[model samples]
Target: MVDIRSPCILVCSIDVKSGFCFGCGRTRAEIASWLSLTSQERDTIMAELPRRLETVERRPRRETRRARIARQRREGQ
Candidate 1:
């Protein structure tokens, strides 16, 4: 699969207070403009995501697609 420079965790809900997605910590505007942004711009946002997510009060209650795939791979081993 081609690499996608996105922070999405397959959970798309937005946190009103933080103005960031619970999964990717991206704002609605950022996510909306993601496809139009250059790779460098995406990378910069991705780099800042970790710290931005720290402010999110809660996380998704379900396993993400990435986590599920990872789990499946580990189990197959």
Candidate 2:
């Protein structure tokens, strides 16, 4: 089984424009691929996260709910 622990901090917020997790500095694709990555890969990503986060400018959390809605709608039965 893949380890599914989230890299999120309490920030729980995201930048809609960049689709980056504010707390963990990971892109949505990176988060999705986490399970398939080796520990070394994960560690490398983790190590680079701080630098990536430094480049991220804070934006208001506008797309959080929208993203959820879109995702749910896409997955709807």
Estimate TM-scores for all models: 0.70, 0.59
Ten consecutive residues with minimal summed lDDT in candidate 1?
59-68
Question: By summed lDDT, which 10 consecutive residues of candidate 2 come out lowest?
Answer: 59-68
List candidate 1 segments past 4 Å from native: 1-3, 60-77
The residue-by-residue lDDT of candidate 1 on 1-77, one tens digit each, is: 55667787777767777898888999999999998898899999999999989988686556656667789999995
- Model 2, 1-77: lDDT tens digits are 56655566645465666666777888888877988888888888888888878766665455554456777899992
True lDDT of residue 61, candidate 1: 52
